[model samples]
Target: MQTSQQIVGQFRRKRLFIAAMVAVLVLVLTLSFRFFEEKSRIEQQSRDFANHTIARFDRMFSPLDVSANNTQALVGLRCGEVRFPLIENLASLQTVRAILLVDHGNIYCSSIYGERAISFSEAYPELAISSQRMLLTTDNYLLKGSPVLMLWTPKTLDNHSGLIQVINIELMSNYLLEPTLPWVERAVFNVGGKSLEYGNPLIEEALPSADEVSYEESSLRYPFSITLFGPPPARLALMTLPSQLPLALLLSMLTSYIVWLATANRMSMAWQISYGLTAKEFMVYCQPIINASSGNCDGIELLLRWHNARQGWIPPDVFIPLAERQNLIAPLTRFVITEMVAHLPVMPRCKSFHVAINVAASHFRDRAILDDLQTLWWPANPVPQLVVELTERDALPVVDQRVISHLHKVGVQLAIDDFGTGHSSLSYLKTLQPDVLKIDKMFTAAIGTDAINATVTDMVISLAQRLNISLVAEGVETEEQANYLRERGVDRLQGYFYARPMPLGDFPAWMDRHLAHIAA
Candidate 1:
């Protein structure tokens, strides 16, 4: 069978393992969710950038298309008659740098330099066909090195006559095709078989393939489309994942701590008890023991109180029985003794005034209780007497009479507490020959209401008087109960009616008030 200590150790290890597993689970789930979310965000950004660039392309060229269509009638007219009209049209359009007239496969007029004798098919074979509407090329006649978008409108369907509008696409490409990195590394404007990317002075010979494009958007009103290229959405999302690690770790730790706190009750309370002892979380409180006949406070019982750091104010019933069961009562009793010795100044400097503490039967083994008192208590040379109350809940071990005699010789008194609550009360009276018999609270509560128990209370008082032992009535709550016990010759009364248990440091003030009230 596992001992309590072994069980406590195993429980602690298991709780820590569970908390670590929860932390790892939380971290993995958070990072996975963030990765997918970032990927979706990057994908959306790419798509929006491509579509917005397409809309700008249409806006830049739609006016040029309208102006070119209006000038198509001047295609067959002489350059002398149509030159001024073309220049006026060009001046009205902000983007159009030049306009040309093409008739019967010959380029004969220009808005910037009129009366041109250039052959349409040799000079520009792509536009001479009159079938293609747009081309991204650097072959602008006036701006030699700059890229331009050529808008074509044919006068007739004979593959001969048309108007050509050269737009300054290179200048507009700065804002129109700008790439927003790291999602979009490059943005390209494609027309026919040519391509122009941001900040490029000349058109590219070939466009990017399908694999290199991240997102592509085409203009519904024009032939051109904007293509965005960069790392894949998943890769870009991964690159940004490092930035989120600190927050993910923090949240995981917080989640783990919360789980640990939630499961604290299930963890070993024995370990908590041991920890409380070491941390000095236990405190000493004293209930005033009033001399019933004189109504004078003559003694106080030192009670153990625990204030756990995590769980505040643990009741004595919860820990006392457990402490005895786990064999920890001996250490706890020693703690109470040490604390009493430290706070001895609070008690009156009179040997007749006693301070009492309950001690478990197991502490008597090998004279452990005696050694604790000698080591921690005797050195202080306290003015008040020390009383050890042995509850009848446990059978008193067979102790040497010399130990009891020696305790009596040194001013320590033995008392039987909670007298009738246990099975061995009468046997305890014969064996221990205690100096004091404390009538348990149940019998005191039966003072008026219970006839049989009240008879039993009277019998106990009669027994104590015949044995020449002083009697202390426990839980004397009402004045009638106090009067009944006092009239029955009970020597001392301990209950809330006199004074509730308070910190030992407050006892001096409480003693002064009680003495003053009695004197008044």
Candidate 2:
């Protein structure tokens, strides 16, 4: 048996928990997407860098290849002439380390040792007279006791002559090796099964596994590839993490707060309605219902009002529907009855002066309301006149003949409120046979206006007259409207034209003033 407060509290907690979970889910997805996006961007950058470096190498060395071809053609036409000026000019070039001219399996001319003949076959067995194609080699040649890259171009002029262009390995290494991006820990350059490397010494010393290499690209024009190694994917993701963390958190909180704001009203109303009965925020106000013909106040209709310390004022139209939807209407109606009974002593003594209290459809379904009314009315020597007003806005529950019969037996009166506004107004009127018919304010507002609404008002007056039912025209704000209803034999008028709904503390004074005005 959970109380309304407990149930409402539980529901609020559940909804807040769901909102938090949704926010967490959104944050997780955002971070995951950012991680992959950053990874893809870094990988693309690495590829671009590799391609640019390889293109740069081709641009740097293309001139050297052309020069080697020119040198071979010159030596072939000259038949290996020992020209000092020709060898001196070629050797003076910055990029050329040494040049050797070989003829008939023997070294004949040299830029470093002019006319110093050496056996080419004995000095370099790797160079064969039969090989006559241009070839580039990277190997440790003992001639300089260091690694060297040789461009060998063979020619035939009378006898076989070979032009050898020797380039120091250090020059090529400097051209190919440079520091890359911060994330790129190392860069490896491989050619003809031989390898060279540059970049962070720590990373070069302890090479990453093949699986750990982030990006690898090979030269499109040469027999070499560049492989880049960096921190693992996980580490790369972490390096870029802090930059996106704040934005992710902001998005998560913004979404969650919007959700909370959207539902804050409903949850607040639930709390107010749950504790309202005990906190005494719920109070009844009254508006005088005047006899249209006599110009005298006949009775007051009770209207519910809520004044919360925190929320200020909550109108009945807003909270009443909520209460009905939540099944809290029964308790609210009971509280109203109890409050009316407490105010019985202050009510006017005139028998004709009645107090009308609106009842919800839920009240008619059970005998509890009947029992409560009986207990409250039993003690009065002459119980105050009471009117039970049922609105047609909601359909009546299954006819509780027992409750209806008991109400009639106890000298209580019933009236249909807000007539013609509900889906089954006529059906309710025919079945319940209430003592009074209160025309809805929408029709009353149209009085003395257009032909259509005037005709509608006339017809309602005619219907009430024929059925012998007391008629009350509501919302008669203007003199023209009030006069029209009075002339049409409207039994009672209840609206702002007569008086606004007043607090109970002010109702008695207002009633006295109205009575005196009528007497005058």
Best by lDDT: 1
Please give the clash total of every predicted structure, in order.
0, 0
- Candidate 1 clash pair list: none
Write model 1 residue lDDT over 101-214, tens digit each, in one string. Answer: 998899899988899999988877777753678877775467687898888888888768899888888878887877787888888888887888887877885355554555
Whole-model lDDT per candidate: 0.85, 0.72
lDDT of 1 at 170: 81
lDDT string for model 2 (241-330, tens) is: 789989999998888788777667655656668788879989988888999989888888988888866556766776787788777887
- Per-model TM-score, in order, reads 0.55, 0.53
